[model samples]
Target chain A: MTTNKTVRLAQRPKGPVKPEDFDIREEDLADPGEGEIRVRNAFVSLDPAMRGWMNEGKSYVPPVGIGDVMRGFAAGQVEASRHPGFKEGDTVTGLLGVQNYAISDGKGVSLADTSLAPLQTWVGGLGMPGLTAYFGLLKVAEAKEGDTVVVSAASGAVGQVVGQIANIIGCRSVGIAGGPEKCDFIKSEFGFDAAVDYKAGNLFGDLKTACPDGIDVDFENVGGDIFDTVLAQMNPFGRIAVCGLISMYNATELPPGPKNLRNVLVMRLRMQGFIVFDFIKHNQEAMTALGGWYKDGKLKFKEDIRDGGVEAFPAVLSELYTGGNFGKLILKL
Target chain B: MTTNKTVRLAQRPKGPVKPEDFDIREEDLADPGEGEIRVRNAFVSLDPAMRGWMNEGKSYVPPVGIGDVMRGFAAGQVEASRHPGFKEGDTVTGLLGVQNYAISDGKGVSLADTSLAPLQTWVGGLGMPGLTAYFGLLKVAEAKEGDTVVVSAASGAVGQVVGQIANIIGCRSVGIAGGPEKCDFIKSEFGFDAAVDYKAGNLFGDLKTACPDGIDVDFENVGGDIFDTVLAQMNPFGRIAVCGLISMYNATELPPGPKNLRNVLVMRLRMQGFIVFDFIKHNQEAMTALGGWYKDGKLKFKEDIRDGGVEAFPAVLSELYTGGNFGKLILKL
Candidate 1:
């Protein structure tokens, strides 16, 4: 028998997730079942969506139950397998939770390739965030050449991919991110046409300057003031793909939605909310296209990997809410 | 020359429009110029959209500038014409403004046929409201057979047509109106599947009971609480054709949008706002279909004709905001 160290949800978070809300535990692992494989997690992804999973409510996915292993996505190599598909030493990625080891039945598990990119990139750019930006901008928003696409959290995982992909597709990409450094990184590293520092006092003014032709597509990640301001700048028949509302995830009560929603009518806008899981069947198509872009030197990615192992999961997760993570956040176990 | 009694926008209303906000005056009407025709207005349409036109801001149409005739839709007889398309004694409908006589260039002027429906019906059922309902339900909301559609402001012009058209297309139609009388009319007269009186309290509970299968299409006319309640009960991949938001028109400041907008993502809802004018090119198709429905007695309409001529435009327009008028509100000159 082996010991598996994991983080468990101790209580449902009322507002921002606190360290006390989770309890770290060591449990004896049973041998894999007939159809299950054991994975030794190399890197666990820390996402804004985790904040939503910690709450007790109905969402796109079920909330993490109390005393259960905290739900998360991780990239790792197979340690032991009784499953027919996954063998020992095969790199795989799936919802493996915030732990050193995970047992899976090969339901959502996918083969991870680190030949072109690093193992951590599989849990960052080439993972859920990449697929989200791909399907969201192309399918949901229907972004086309000559369209002006605006992305919030522009230097982060999904936003970086969204802006870079928009550029590759012949559209003008404008990014909105916190701090001057993140903004500069989006324009210089991601090749976005422009970047606005939302943390600066002149967000609306900077947005107006960035999108002089008016925003045609809005890839919304952060909700609240940023969402509202971007909405005001949308052109007629604008398409908004609402991927996440990270700003509102930690609120104790329902926050007021965009007051300028009246523009949805006046400007004849189409606003839709979508979960990346909905496009699971089309993952191959997204992977093929994104991989091509990556190999062609058109797509670039950065990771903010922390090396404190599973014990640092609670403190590191809060960094996402505070905008402390500079890129795709990952925990190295 | 003829003396035309007109209602002009005196000042932009701060909140709900008042009599002081408009000036009722008599001006000498100019004769029809080259290719122009003059129409003697018999009935002027009083639509909730007119309230939006009163504001000094950009909308689907330009605002009615202060000191200019308050823009409106009217049906009347052509008194004089120099245009080959129109002649004296011809019944016509167009944007004739809130006045006794209007000089036009025959642009957008449609010949009214009162053989089956009344002349005022040209500006009501067979006009912008009817077109809005037809396109909104069929095209925007994409209501198909067996789909459950919920319409707000069910007794009003657009709502009545929306519910009835949904039923005609083999979809289940449910209505949310203000009072018991309006609610009863929707069921008894309009042939709706069910009606919920929003003013009777138990809005959320009643909506749940009414839409047990969950709303697939939401023909949203009245926003605010009604919109929020209906949103909570929407099914996955639901479509919302936002026709109007009359409840928010009179507010001095922007009211909070639906707090449950997060459902847009969880349920993968598609919400689009559209203007009737955007479908103007397809007006003939809509008119032909709606007129056929009217002549076949498959669609019935009632008008809340308010007398006191154009002078009463200020007071009568308020009736729409107050829910005092039933059916299609029209002001007879």
Candidate 2:
């Protein structure tokens, strides 16, 4: 009998998560059933979407129930398999949980290389975050060459790729980061045309200076005041691709509304929000293009990995809400 | 010398317009300048946009100045012309003011015929309101077939035509009118799939029932509570054509905000607004298509004409703001 260490939900969180809300417990596992494989976990993904999964609502997916293992995307080495395609020591990624071991019935399970890019990198720029940036920016936003594009959370996993991809497409990309350090990283390190530090106390003024021709497309990761300010500055017929609303994810009450909604009328702007999972069918084409870009040195990746077992679930998940993670947030067991 | 009676802007109103705000005056006739033509006013358009024309701002056009004739669109006869294209007794439509006689530079002019449709019908479906409905619904919303489309102010000038066009394009068209009379008019006269009275309470609930398939395209002319309610009922990737905000145009203060803006995040909806004046270049092709539809009997047109002299300006303009006009609002001088 194998004992599995799993991070289980002990209590529902009120606002930001507390350590006591999770309990890392050891549980005995049964033998793998027919057509099922038993895998030992190597890495688990921590993302901003996990915050929505923790709460009960009508979102893209169902919420994680109390007493259940924390829901996550994980990669692991196959220890045993009764399925046709599986073999011993094969590495795979799937919607596994925050645990040392998991059983899968071959649905959405795919083999991955831990050598080309770290297992954590796949959780970020090479994986979900990468595809999210690619499809949302190019397809949803319909970004074209010579367009002036703006992205929020510039140094984060998705924002980093969005700006770089815009650059590759011959567009001028402006990024919105939180501080001077991240702003410098996007401009110098990530090759963004310009980066705005929102916390610098002159958001609109700085944004005005950075975007001289007016924003043609805005990849909106931050909502609330930032959204309102950007709405006022958008050019006529501009498009907004809203991938996340991290600014209002943990709000106890609804944030005050966009008062300058008249600008939406005057400028004729198109603002759209999307969940990345909807692009699952475009996986092969998306990854192939991203992989080609990576190999050609046209794309870059970043991973903010936390080394710990299932015990770090609560803390790692909270880091996304608090903006503690610089890139894709991941935990390795 | 013949005297021309006209309605002039005596003062700008603070909130709702009053009778004293207009001056009934008689002015001497002036000959048309070079390349200009003189038109004797037959019909003057009364629109909610006139409210914005009273204020000094950078909109689609200049504001109506104090002591000037209230700026508007009108259809009349070319009693005299200094231009080659126009001649004496030719029926024409141009941006003539609320007056018995006006001179135009022939900068903008259209020939109107009652045999093609009624004189009022041209103003509503074949004219400005028609172009507003046609371009805003098709070009701005990018509305497609099999989409579920909903429109606010359903019995008004723009809303009625938007629903009819959505229906003709294989979309399920739903309308939000003010009363049972208008609701019936939207369903029976306009051939809309369904109608809802938002003022009957439970605005959001009514929208939900009216559009069970979920709203794919929302033509937003009345903002405030209607916009708040529509935001919640949108389907994933829904498109909103934000045309006007007649509800809040006269309000002294900003109305209370929407409650569920986070829906913009969860559903990935798009909202945009525009003015028809910006699309003058598309006039030839647009009117040709509209004329084809009209000739095929695939579309219907309606107008509500209130006849009087310059004394009718205050009463006619007031009807537009109060949901009192059944189709298009027009003042025949």
Docking class of 2: acceptable
TM-score to native of every candidate shown: 0.78, 0.76
lDDT string, candidate 2, A214-256, tens digits: 9999998887788777877888778888888878876888776
Q: Candidate 2 has which clashing residue pairs, if any?
A: A273-B268
Point to the candidate with the largest TM-score: 1
Q: DockQ for candidate 2, please give it.
A: 0.43
Interface RMSD, candidates in the order listed: 0.9, 1.9
Question: Taking the tens digit of each residue's C-alpha lDDT, what string does model 1 give over B205-316?
Answer: 9988888899999999888889998988999889999988877776889988888888888898999999887776676678778887888888888788888998999999
DockQ for each numbered candidate: 0.62, 0.43
C-alpha local distance difference test of each model? 0.89, 0.81
Query: What TM-score does the predicted chain A of each candidate obtain versus native chain A?
Result: 0.88, 0.86
CAPRI grade of model 1: medium
Query: B132-186, model 2: which lDDT tens digit per residue?
Result: 8889889988899999998998887788889988988899999998988889988
